[model samples]
Target: MTVYPTRLTQLSLLALVVVSMVLSLTSAPTMAGQTYSYTLPQQAYSQSRARDYQVYVPDNLTTPAAMVMALHGCKQSNADVLADWGLTAAADQYGFVLVAPFISSYDGLRNENCWGFWFDHHRHQGRGEVEDLHQIGLAVEDAFAIDPERRYITGLSSGGAMAVVAATAHNEYWAAAAAASGLPYGEDAASVSLTGQCPGSASFHSVSQVASDMAAELDDDYPIPLMVLQNANDCTVLQTAANNIRDGHLQVFGSDGSSQGNSEASSTACSPYYQDRHQCQHTRYTENGQAGQRSLVETIFLDGPLATPNLQDTDHGHYWIGGEHGNNGKWSVRVGPSYPDIVWDFFDRHPKNGSTSGFPVITLIGNNPMTVNLGEPFTDPGATAEDSEDGQLSVTADCSDVDTTTVGDYFCTYSATDSADNNTTRERTVTVVDPNTPIETCEQATASPDTHIATGRAYAGGTSNLRAYASGDNIDIGGSFDTWSQVTLHEGVPGSWYSSEPAACGDDSNPGDTVCTDWQDTNLNHSLAGRAYYAGGYFSYGGDDYLGAVAGLSSWVRETAPGHYQSGQCP
Candidate 1:
């Protein structure tokens, strides 16, 4: 037997029920993470403007883990990006620290939380957004033991452009970078907007031109591998911007725009990440570096049928592709390739050393096997060392065991050590012989010895001239050598022994003496001059005058006869 409740009591019960339901629906999900906030004071690097940023440290984070700076698109908040783009979950699963910076509304170039990547000040190191972001990275390092070799940055749209800026401007601080639906670095707003409307003329600058700009602005020559993602139907950022980014990065990496070829991607050979979504075209660019052919840039183009009839639909346009369904914010899609997984995978392959480890690459500059006369003072040919994070490092040689008095085989060890305690060492073999021992001719040394044939042209640098070898019926170096008069020397001479020292010429040269050497140039990036035999000396390509130029010993020879040069001491 139940008693009927009064109208007042029933109304109170209904109100309590409504309040309970509201609280249940609006309660935030329990997360095994903690969020910290900070406001960077006005500093020179930040253009004397205070900037705010947030960091999300997931539970069970291990020390020396990778830190990914996750940037949000226009009109988006850090919290919105972390949740909608599944960055929070990615942090928890991947065990990485995430940093997100907020654009101040009071800033002169602020556009609804868009980063100031379009302006010149924002594109360089220690200036505007690039500096603000770098400060945030430094702040994170203070709180965590982030792997200096594993620091990476990625973003979408405007954030994508800013990521490019930060990664390139302070390139030494970052290991790798990824951008989705973003404009090329240093692109003006007018150009970007115009390209967005007219896809045909989307690329404002040539790929090589853009690459030159990027190379000029880099803090170090160590190329930062970049991953570019684009949607085929994206009308906002358009496919043209992605093309610019992909091609420009490839050019900077010295790649020829050739794909690494993944059969599972783009083709029907394998299903897309989402069966119902569009397929992705995966093209990877590789260059022959000191480490061999290595992947430097990868472009992921999402292609398939559109979700709507309108081409300008923002809902189906530029976004962080493959975000969680029903939980994404504006510019985040639930279909196509998974950006988080793809970007992280790419970043994991490339570290500060250009590999998974911190070890630097040590390259011997001169010849590997060298010959010296007994009782003659042996001057060791130096080597060049480079690390991805540390840039160029000082190389030290250990020639203590060498005894010029005795004739035997010895080793000269060259080593390079970085601040991270990572080290690399290389060896050069030195052979000492009796002073009376006759030097072996090229025919006696090898079955087939190529001729020391090369051409030279008088450069118009007033005092400077150009002399390079012609190999295999073509000018060894790519480019036009036309209109330049060819001066031949060292012809008919077998290329057996090459000198590592410059020829004594001009006031010091005595007549009727010939000195020549075949020199091999070792550049880690493989972008400059190549292996060639030159007379009248070889300049060290490792300098400011050329890309990836390192300071080293130059080789020179004097002309004694027509088309004939010999390797001997200068008189």
Candidate 2:
């Protein structure tokens, strides 16, 4: 169901938090000694579940600029996110626009108004919560400049789950995504309660299953670079469920399990936001075949308690952790002191690699309706893909089943992917046909009755192959000289001769129709009967009598001339 905000949009006077790129890269997020507020319009865009949101611009770069959206966890407000998280801090340091959005109240939720993560929910693409958030993005674009290449989104807890969905479903919009303490593909987020006491319940799945399912959901051609922020000491969210954020992305990127690419423990002198020494770990993964070539996904693990005591009025529950506390008061801070600086450094490195757009587009090139002659060689025109960012893409066509050697409709398909992770596809079809066969000339003379045939070709001038007029399929209705099944030599006849199903011969009209009965029932004709045997061959309009049942077949009595009767018996 589409989520509709309970209240209509209301216009308000502008209050924008402005930041400067001139600020030190290693410093924490700050207002940089200036604040400007712009009045948001009554509405940004229409959505069933639309709601109010706030935006902070670091600097108004008239050219396209980057935009980062953050979603809060349960019982958390847009205001709370802006105050506690380092996204705003980074927005100031990097001169990017920061967006804060709200979610609806979840049913049976442990925290009030938490983001919803039901198993049945449609969490991909422009549906559900992502749709609601996208409208807010459109509003931000309309209000300020947004670099199409640098758009990014991240979230915490339940919001973290939402972030992954938004990125996976609509990868074209986000160049990269960072999910802090959330499950990818929404696994294990749904529960009877918010607490982590019963994580092993059947309602949740194993790390491998979660990783596999989430990986299967992603499009290989459009994998958005991801950073999974996890805490080593998080007690509220189990380490297994949380780690899939990184594992799932690696699986999607075709990684075989993984190994740590970077790690730092007990590093001091890291930030202005923290007085305590910082501890951090960075794990990186690359695509399977391209290992040591390009890193596709990474995870940052920090164990921390907020170094800046009383940064917020409340306690540090499930918050970023630093050096371990004696009471273990809160989970380790996966995103430690000066989180924005470290996070931004990673984001800055992975921009859109292919086209400026999301995925590649493909086009099939060939005759709209193609044709191939019987026994002729055919080559498919195939397809090609073009990406604005990645340029021309690699295409592969599958034509293993195409049989131009025989007459039939054959389908050939092509697929392609660009470096930027976009994909496109196209297909073409070729119809095989034989213009004529040797069966239409019914010029056989009436042979002497009861004459034993010596040679097989004596009956029809040695040209026994005839296309069945009733079914249009080639059938061996004559003697050893006939080989219609091999080359469709009987196409001269109007109607198809044989059945597509070889079993149709079992239903052949008994007696005279028993000769040459092993015809394919392509036309589904079950009434092929009445033809007599020539040269002792048992042909079928549809008969199963195989071992040369020539007794009732020699009686072909169709009279061609007024005075002479054509005989089924060969003399």
Candidate 3:
């Protein structure tokens, strides 16, 4: 047995020693992805003691990256946050870090776990939990290469409630924040009564109350932009609660500007005023749909004093993860470019300390000719400038020299200036042309259907009166066609016709009268069919009903005579 206690025994001894050493070494526990979970120091709270959070850091850390803290809802764990949100993939793709903290419960029951803070109560109640979150944020900054300026907080349901609380309470720490299916403020006693025993009422606070408290903390000169997302159909948080929070902000900021119009009926608009007297856009989203269905409301707030409102249709029931709801209140997650992209875009646009430099481009309507006259007043184009920082826009035009006499091209330039002094100029062109010309008097114009005589067509022979109608451009002349002008005709050679004009023929002096001479030879042959004929002279018919080659008498030569005379003689 002196031969080193059998090979198997020696290996077993070695394994035991190794296990003991590992237990003593304080190594982190490994999880699903080989990620390590560690615990921080515990803190005390009103109902329970706070525990350190578990965070997952990607291995691809090279440079500093944005940090996103995803808090868990009531009765949900760090692991639940991870699994439900499935944000690891997004973190990997977007090159950001993720941290999830646990809100330990008094009861050992894991399902009782929740974020310690409440929306409708005093912040002091959740001191331990808030401290833990603050520490966790600081710890993340220390543990990972985090861009302090780009830190963000987002969550779902209860978690979302906490995220809003954290972001609004600690605005200095977070660049931007988003909450899904979360109330803007905590539940009050009345709200609790309405919704039944609100489980997270310990630290609930009204959004208006919170805003009032936070007013002092906010930069009076420039406040941070806050974006809120809520399900119109969220039965738990109730969309009205969120509206109260937004209204509080409006009251503090002073609603001195117009709200941007939106089509979503459930949405309300508000604006925030900065110290610079500029208006920032703020909007509230709410549930809007028939009962028993899903709907969504979203709102964005800018940094200015004035608010602009925009809205869109969204899904209901706490859909921050974005997908169909699974069995256990879990949402089936699907990653998209929009969520992370919007997060980054909003973060990029709004900086911590009133810096609008390097913001994204926003285009606004410039002054253009909505209407223009043919030649009268000269119109000039106007434009205004837009900037990522100072959106103040004003447009001016130089229309003093617009030429009305010339029928040619005219150009007007407009200059725009924003609050930051950024300028943009645009020009619009207008053209003037002469009014459409009227057809010459008595000219032949075709008539459709040939049922009634049209203006500008000639009439030859018979009792068919040749009428002349004239239409004026840019002027109005009143009278019926029968009163304007008339023409008459008479027989010349057998079957031939002669026409006469009122003034030209000495017989029919009345302006509306008609006379006939050799109309077919004079007017019909000279112009096309349907052309108006200006009879030059008058003529007469046979005696009684027919004056033979008689002078001074005029009659219209009817192709069909009244008596049916085949030859030239009255019965």
Candidate 4:
């Protein structure tokens, strides 16, 4: 008889996880790899209670491979857990690290080998099971180079319950976690005793009740992706347990315009598991992060009509059992699905920064090996940067001492650091050259003197009756040279015409006291009448009351000569 799934009712709120994979591989013989055990550095399981787990390292283990911490149900060993998931060949083919941690088997009467999934002692923080698992994952990180965004956790039964608890409490440490046949966490929630057999009579709390408890424990803003796998006819852990898990996830992951569209998945077979008459349907809900990237939460339903205690473990399918009709397993319970591919595909899409390396890239622009003329302006060509986490980044530049005015080579550096502290830089060389030929001579300018016609002579006293000197004679204003002082002193001669002022009268014959000798006018006119003036006039020897006999309606003018000024600079 096949058990059909009851229609799920709409719950108020909950959660999201990774995208599915499409890779198809044949289920080859289980090539058992080397499984090694690791001991906890510090005592976490229980004081004095030794804690250790085993990991299967494939022969072809590559750098930065994805890791999955597969947890086993009660009475299951690490090897059994790995075998149960049917991931040995898949791990080899997909190139991932498969880790199966056997829950520390305590000597206690109650806390034996089973994970303390639903217990008051394990619910809260501080020296507890959840903290221990987180530390172990961190330890695993230290031991391997697994991608932070590719690290995940999945389990069966109580181990499944622990997966849910660990993922929610410590979302920062994991990329995603899928709990197969698990229960909602919290001390108040209903639970079953691991000491008993499969399908114990334990009543599960309502989905809302579980959601309320989770809402209190988990941060409302913490939206990590979750994938819940439910077995419809599960009696070992009832179908309602899976429903509660799904509803709680949906509630915690609010649809407050923060999340993206939903994707529904259905497949006849994925690999070794689903091939043999098993059915699978998946629903993936995602949210666009502030960077417009993807964060997801997915839930898968694996159930179909099968008899009670179905020899294939079909009815109480407490495992992720599906495959592409390989129909290859020692027992009906062992053979099933292509879970690894679905998981890998999902993890591939969601990194801390949208399938990116969580870093920024800096690109340089403008002239490289730039050649510029001396004295010419050389502007720095800048750079740009981008980061998936921080989006488009701001950049700054530094030119390595390039003198555009002087001829030389220089380097310009462009750099930027994203918000995530990812640094990027680029450099360019700039060469400045003086390409113009040199010049020898430059232009020159000079000035020459012109004739100065005196306005009149500046005299010591009045000169009356001296040819009736006009009012214009002997007048000085505005500091203008009163007398005809602007005269051409012939190369060696004192003056042919000097201002007749007392001290400057070259007409006098006083030795060393302003005297003149052999002086001639512009027309070779020389007067020896004790004192000579221009226009053929003469002032008497002693007291020339005529004030040196005014010049002929005196007037003055100036002239200049051509110059020889040089180019580049005035010479």
Candidate 5:
């Protein structure tokens, strides 16, 4: 018997693996299923040092069965995971395939025969062991007719933490996740050893922060549910870690840890019936009171009479509880309310609803609609791209079209492509405006006897009174004012303006009535026919489209400002 390192310190792990090799020579437990070795294909996108894995196909297993990836703890083999964790029996009973992958070789810093969950390279998808494990799962899925929605992952101790990392980093890959006696997502063995707490040190992000970071590019609409098993008497991992896991997942699912419309399930409820059943307290959390919303988080803490030691830390309560009776080994305890049974039940209820391409999403770092003044230098704020498979990708920005010297609307385009060739593009509008351009104003002289500036509101598509002076009678101007046009009066020639024809300028018979002169469309100025004149040059009220116009008699006009003009004044 070897004293396995239950914790994930590099030094302890290195020493433990040297002796654990002896146990592999011993005969494995006789399971109802057949177990075989699988060498995972090396992925060019990953830096994984571990590849060898094992699979257990239950007797009489059929197509469309569920698949579970079981990661083993430190100083443990894949065989130990299947036989010790009672997954072999569970697979036989539930008719699901069991995939047990372990660290076959010792990476310099990562623990030998243990998961690299605490290592930065392996914590995310498509990088290190995370990618290796994902490839292994895919390989198994291809080999067997596994249901995509029924995929799941579970682990113990260091493996437990890896399970969380995998499920979060690749949310679309797994339907559910369970961790037994595991550390939080970002916690390190050193910090956990010192404080016996989660979110171990400030050097690493908190559990909630890790969860949020993992979900930054994930779809929030379909969050993966999580189940955590904590041994209350376990001093190796500490029970506080379970709280961190529960709280972190609650944040991921946008739950406040309380039932919105459904009655809250008590955390103190424990199952007392099963053989050798420890006082197992269960707590469950749901996203909301929605009719079909299932529990997003669940926690089970086991505490009772201490069982005989299977290996080191069994007395510490850090081993897997409720395995096969009378056939216990390293980290395996024959206690009640079986861990495998509980995990399988939780996983069965939650399945993925839709498919995801694992595509990268490009998110603009700054404002989507940005403003840049004319003649000022314009700098693109840039963007960020993240993928479910590829962690972070380089974003290319094409802002060459955004010229600040010109007063017009422009766009800055950004795009990113992942290693898998999944690409995404995003655009931000850049508007350039000339600040020096003069704003047209309507100044009404209150006491001027020659002119009166009357300000009125003009509606769109109204009958036009101001005419361009056609062949004989006063004809309406062909161009109408834009919508919500403002009617402003300014002091100008009392006659109406006509298009280039001098004959159309005046009504010779009633000479004092309608006076007209040359007013071109190129210039902003125009003249009115009624008592008031369109004195102010054309100006935009908000943008370059709106212009000052004369109010038609039929148009709805409330006098914003009023002034009197002598009726017969002509210039």
Candidate 6:
């Protein structure tokens, strides 16, 4: 028997159908290569579920690729984070899968949810957030054909802080991690903000405190290598905070259980403590002598049983990633071939022990031949060593051809060893030539200021006196001759010339004259007697003092001969 429905029941059924339709219309669709957010089950506090992130899979995905998780800062969206960090270009070039997660709010503050690196002090904050992030990374790895062992994490600013937390907390999972402009857990304001009131609390761990905790949790002997980038001039986060974090980690990892002392002076504009610790190799990239150049400082603590290495730098700011920063404050999309090149290099040296696979094959430029002339020094052109496992390998030259005596074509072989110990050898021939060339000598000659002039030219028809001056190169002629004499032109003429005789007179014998043979003046020749000459004057012998006074008046001038100087000439 068919029964007619009551009016109230029919209306209820119609309302249920309308409600189902509305729910279906409002629900978001699961699209390809898109991230979706879900609300987590309600706990003590209203917390959100982990976000599900996906990216478009290339048509060719035969080989297993690496995966990287990029986390966003508080109040930042996935799109903005992607735009700022921009790792897609690197992903495309290196065939690595990339994922980025967004945080929407904190304590119901609209658009205020940041990574919990700083706010973890609250019971329901940092741990849950970190777990969610871990789940998301595993989900992405499972969804894509990614190599779990090759998983990596890196971030900037707060995101950078998160990366540090993840690396320290989950060191077993990440092969390598890099943090820029961010400190370990206990180093940031989060630590102070959470534990400021409880100053006496002994069990409390600051953000930086977490690094020591995490290091303790990991195999202390070989903890994962961490790369930190910081800026010395960063106005936002003082460089001291970063150094403190570095020092704290060093203290935790060092054998002495104490941090190195500050070695830099205040006048140098660097923290003395930083210089001292860096010398111990406890930090990386701490000394930035050049502008924009990255400093890498490292220290090894806990030998053998448990060793943890620490690296630090002071040339990066919040949002400043490793490498060069763009003018617009965005990481460049173009990853130079060298970018992936270096990443692989760091990775090869640090291997995931779980896998026995060899490092990637690398072909390097080999060394070339060089030539040097005899007596000429020559430096090797240098050979390049490459390994198929590691990219652009480093080469050490045996320099067999480098000898003190060998002059013929010599062969020097260069050997390159990869991180895996795979080695390759290359030989280069260098031709040493012997040439004959004369070694020239350079000498300079000097002249003294000395002159002997005949008075016959001036005293032609009558007795006249002649005065002469002399000069030469490097000559010193301040004093006159020892003896002086003059001979009369006519023979047997007593007193024919009157007055004092010339102080610098010729010898009494008249050595160079035939006329008036041996005729001589009794006094020394005073060549310049105060502008007076003994012409037709009587000869008279005078004391040495009289001759010296007349000789003092006669001045000598110096002159340089043309083309008499040389420069840069060996004597």
**Model 1 off-target regions past 4 Å?**
1-30, 106-110, 194-203, 255-272, 275-277, 289-293, 304-313, 357-571
Superposition error at 36 for model 4 (Å): 1.9
Q: Give Cα distance to truth, residue 249, candidate 1, Å.
A: 1.3
Q: Which window of ten consecutive residues has the lowest lDDT sum in model 5?
A: 451-460
Question: What TM-score does prediction 2 earn?
Answer: 0.48
Cα lDDT computed for each candidate against the true fold? 0.57, 0.49, 0.40, 0.50, 0.58, 0.38
lDDT per residue (tens digit) for residues 1-571 in model 6: 1122222232233222111110100011111232323222212222434343334333344457777676655434454443323344335434566666665444522224456665544212224555556655655554567776777776655666777777666666676665544556544353322222311111224535554555554543434545554544343333444555555544444334334343211111111111011211123322222211121212211101011110011112223321111111122111111222234333433434433244333222222234557657656545433333343566777675565355778777767676777665656566675554322111111221111211111111112111222111111112223124331121111111212122233345665332211111222232332212233442211111221233333322111212111111112
Candidate 4 lDDT, tens digit per residue, 39-100?
54434343323346666666768878778887776655564554435566657755677777
Q: Rank by lDDT, descending? A: 5, 1, 4, 2, 3, 6
lDDT tens digits, residue span 15-122, model 3: 221111111000112122223354544433333243545555555654677777877765456765554354554455445677777765433322255453442232
As a whole number from 0 to 100, the lDDT of residue 515 in candidate 2 is 31
Clashes of 3: 51
Task: For candidate 1, give the lDDT.
Answer: 0.57
Summing lDDT over every window of 10 consecutive residues in candidate 1, give the lowest-scoring window: 18-27
Q: Give lDDT: candidate 1, residue 274.
A: 29
- Cα lDDT tens digits for candidate 5, 1-571: 1122211232122322211111111112346667766565444564655377777887788878889999888767786676557677668766899888867775656445767777777777667887777777877776678889889999988888888888777777899999998776766656344343332332334766756666663543567888898877666676677777777667666555443224234354333213445767766666563322456777887775444433233355567764432124466665555677678766765667633344565555434456788999998767766454554589999998998878999998888998878787777788897877532222222221111111111111112222111111122222232223232323212212112223323236855454333222322222242222433423211111223353322221111112112221124
Q: By how many angstroms RMSD does model 1 differ from the true structure?
A: 28.3
How many clashes in candidate 5? 1
Candidate 1 colliding pairs: 319-331, 498-518, 502-556, 503-556, 537-555, 537-556, 538-555, 542-549, 542-550, 543-549
Q: What alpha-carbon RMSD in Å does predicted model 2 have with respect to the real structure? A: 32.5
